[model samples]
Target: MTAQRDMKEKNPWHMSGMVALAVIGVIALVTLVAVMVIQNMPLAQKYKYGIVLDAGSSHTTVFIYEWPAEKDNNTGRAEQKHSCDVKGPGISSYVGTPWKAGQTLRECMRQAEDNIPEKRRAETPLYLGATAGMRLLHMKNSSASEEVFRAVSDTLQTFPFSYQGARILSGQEEGAYGWVTVNYLDNRLKQGLRTTGALDLGGASTQISFVPQALDGGGSPGNSVTFRLYGNDYNLYTHSFLCYGKDQALRMALAHHTQSGPMAIKDPCFHPGYAATKAYSDLYDSPCVSDRKPQGAPESFLHTGIGNFQQCQDVVRTLFNFSQCKYSRCSFNGVYQPPLQGHFGAFSAYYYTMSFFNLTDTSIPLDTVKETIARFCATPWQQVKQENPGTKLKYLVEYCFAGAYLITLLTDGYNFTAETYADIKFIHKIKGSDAGWTLGYMLNLTNMIPAEAPDTPPLPYSGYVTIVTVTVFLLLALLLLVGRTFRPSCFKRSLII
Candidate 1:
């Protein structure tokens, strides 16, 4: 009997042993199921793409953006994948020869085709948003603008992407979207953090947008734009000044100095020793200065430079009309603007011009910034060229004027004081995306940014897996303990015998 009892205990199929085996089988099953679930879950990421063509005043840029296929409505998911600058000027430049504008986009569109995956190409939405340049063209010649649009539309339709219509973005939209781009990339919208202002200085226009502490009831209602994003409401103050862009502003300044129709005039904005013959017709071609053309003006005039920063600022300030304001307050030209608020991101030409002079760092005192620009402006034209070898002559010569104009625009036109000037950060890009309206424009059109926060899993995939694995092991240990403690009656009786 003793030998039989010992044999039963030694038998692996005895009740306790059987129970332990069962527990192990359960563990194996649970582990296998867990792994299968995890593996079957969408472990690999797939992406969707979007294409936005930023048709600006100076040039056109193609921006390709991508986001996770499943998380389109999530914040910060969309990012700039690739960008191509369409060679030549903006489409508005092809007023008479509109077909050439369409041709200009072909190379860039082909590049877009190469960058986006074939699978995603068909579904990818393509959009073209023209800014100030087109607006000006439309005002000057509506028929020519329409033709340009039609031509651009025809060219875009040829691509496999889902071509959305091309149209001009209003100044308000331009300013607001630029604000969105800056704040979105900063992740401020998602987290419900304080927002940053956006200052976009384009070739044909400039935009200022920000959220003020309070909206004055007496302020101009036209300047206000409200949006509900991520369960938060934002009241934005945005304005785009027409004919206030760097290039346009330059024309205005030159127009101011050449009112007498002189054969030669010395411009304070340009570096000393600079001389260029500019046609009166070319200068007066734009609607900004067309009315100001001197009657019976010479065909061309000799333009010379004196390199005076203070005088250049005085010249630039003449363009702004601070004389009248129907509203509670004004920035310039009687345009209503609330008190400046929060940090500001200066982009596009603001970044480019400041980057050229190494004045992008806002930490540098306002006086120091002025001193630096003054020094550059005072530099002789030949010396400037020699210092920047291989640089385009047209752009290089204009930097002094551009620099003086920027400082004056900020301080005099926008009313940014020396203390407040430090709040401005000259940024061309934030994270990987360009700090412009294109991404924001895309996000708005696609509904990629949800009005409310998106639902998310309680734990990350890895954390959940670890917890599940640990829980399974713990359950198995408890099951084994129970199995050992409560043996079957038959087994107990056998042991007793």
Candidate 2:
């Protein structure tokens, strides 16, 4: 009995010894779990930055964007942090003195420099994309355009940010990027949602882009662009009409009106009190008006406002040639387009004119817009200025004409009927970011647009925690139960043997 008692006592599975073994096992299991938790914890977030400069015809703007480092290709990771509009006209306007183009960018570049952190300044990419104004300038005088590029490039090179090339963006590129911008900002591209069509109106051009319902319905391959984004293929139809923007269109319409001779041109689009004189050379300079320009003898035409919406619509309607089309369907001027699918976003001048004329809200019918334009056109030009104090007088006086032209363009040129008109939403900005092509351009150049979704765990974070917690406890319980059942009497016997 004494030997048996000693044997029992010697065993490590004695009650107190079992309790101690259990405490050690718990500590070891806890240590293992703590190590795994440390391994799974997410690292601290780090952010990176980038910059893009939109040197548009009417104005120039600098856009600064940032994204987190770990999520380089994630949708919505990059967002606009700041944007600065360069003072005075666009870089293309500095044609006569090309060096001044570089000088014009300094103010905005300073703002960009101030906004970016010192460490990131060197790594951030800076890009300048000149649009239609430069395109026209390049067509008219290649040397002047080259000089302008040289000037802007020199200035950009001086900045600490990485300077990507500065040059003209093809109209197709402009339209594609504009489409990408709208869809990206809408979060559609990333989320695999149906995309909105983009209609961008600049000073010298207008572009329409959308993913067609029938991918092959788009008329020509040249007018279409294909992109694989987030594991989905997008076949987009895009076309940019040169000299179709409000500013250039106005120039062409005025030229068409004065073909009768340069005396006291009565323009129905302008308010009754408005009068402006445009030189013949100035009108002739545009490709839209070159053919209609009078024989070398004419000086200038005096334009007087008549303020008639019906007449204005008539004039604007003549600007588009609806008669000619090779495709089963065309928007205008033989440009092929599928029946527009989904909603449309009209930005730039579209938003400006619509907002100024109280047509920004949805459900604004064609007749409703026409009625507003007629009333606003009748308002004396002076009263118009007073209502929109400090507004650029040029744009203010032209609002009546712009409103009429916008209505005519949509109804006649694009065939957006009153029934479907509500789908056309005019927006200048999306989530504080200007709805323009520059952001999308930058996103593409930096490879931020991923072709596939990033790999993610099948289970969610909560599922992981619950699974691990339950699994660890179950495993530890099994080990404890086995230890309790096996009894340490074997250890005491082994010592004797």
Candidate 3:
């Protein structure tokens, strides 16, 4: 009995050990269940998505891309690509009365939902980002502006899943993001030819970006690009000069003329090259008396013929150089300082330069050029809508212009310029109305495959990303340091493995 009692005492800790084991088992089971629940949730439901509602000076585009899907640990399948759409009128320069931009978005979403399967329709996420239109809406007296934005936000909140925020992407970021999406999807501009530059021309603004290739060493060179965007992503370390668009430039020129007391002399320093000058001349230069009558003349003289590729090149160079021009006015005195250039010439100069100067010398076969322009010009909305379903054709064309410009600028070794001028044949073939992905056309134009540039280094001045990162990091660090005083247990809890 004594020996039995001693044995029982020796095994006394067994109960405590069993209790500990049970507690640990329950904890592990709960953790596994929680993870399973999270994993099973659809990506749109679990992850936050962003919306870039670009309300331009003349138009608006609401771009919503499904957030990159996360790889599921348990199932081992990648998340699926998701898409959403919404739109509003360009409110950037709107005046007089507020329009139904918000209602337009609601209508667009409703249309999109109508097209989706009922089951899948409820699974998707949505967001709205307003741009120039909103900025101009608030302008000097923002009381009304704030109210409009608040109204937009409130209306957006009515949806099951939606976010409404001001989208003030910097010029550089706008260019960079566009480029990133292009290259990420198409893989253009790889290795030595990876250096890229872009110019986006709009009614009220122009934007440019320069992306350099990766060096043999894995670091990016400190090069900068200048373009247009309002002051949204200033932190992205870009230069956005406002009132520098073509119309703005023209307006500026006229304004400067008025400011300089009339009959201002032309400054030869800041001159547009042949193509750009011609474009400007076509628009503003007086017609020759020898060519046509004063009032009833054909408008052809007023319209600059579509610029050839070489003409575009010359214009681009002129524009870039013109920005540095020092105008000297021939004042009654020997000469006065020439007035500064404005957005009209400057803005046009940028597009001409980007399209011509930056591109490789591949002659777009005259046939191809004619066909492309004709098809593009004649492409009906119904056909495109039937094929691409919900995309805007104008946006795709603009994207193509940017892509073509980038490809030409970067791939100089291709002898495309010389060949283009001499023997390249243009073919106008529209394969289908569904060709909404402009990358395909752009890639074929340059004979580049989209898989070539998977890991190329991004440009140095990627707009607000750098600033946003630093700000977020600083805020996180401060929170950590301060929170330790009030909730030291929080820190200890975080440290627990």
Best by lDDT: 1
Off by more than 4 A, model 2: 1-42, 72-76, 215-219, 448-497
Candidate 2 deviates by what RMSD? 6.6
List, residue by residue over 16-68, the lDDT tens digit for candidate 2.
76686578777767756775676576655556777888988899999999766
Q: Can you give the TM-score per candidate against the true fold? A: 0.84, 0.82, 0.39
| Tens-digit per-residue lDDT, 234-266, candidate 1 | 999999999999999999999998898999999
Candidate 3 per-residue lDDT, tens place, 306-332, comes to: 323343333323222222222232111
Candidate 2 global TM-score: 0.82
With a 3 Å backbone cut-off (N, CA, C), the pairs that clash in candidate 1 are: none
lDDT-better candidate, 1 vs 3: 1
* Models sorted by TM-score, best on top: 1, 2, 3
- Which model, 2 or 3, shows the larger lDDT? 2
Candidate with better TM-score, 1 vs 3 = 1
Off by over 4 Å in 1: 1-42, 71-76, 217-219, 448-497
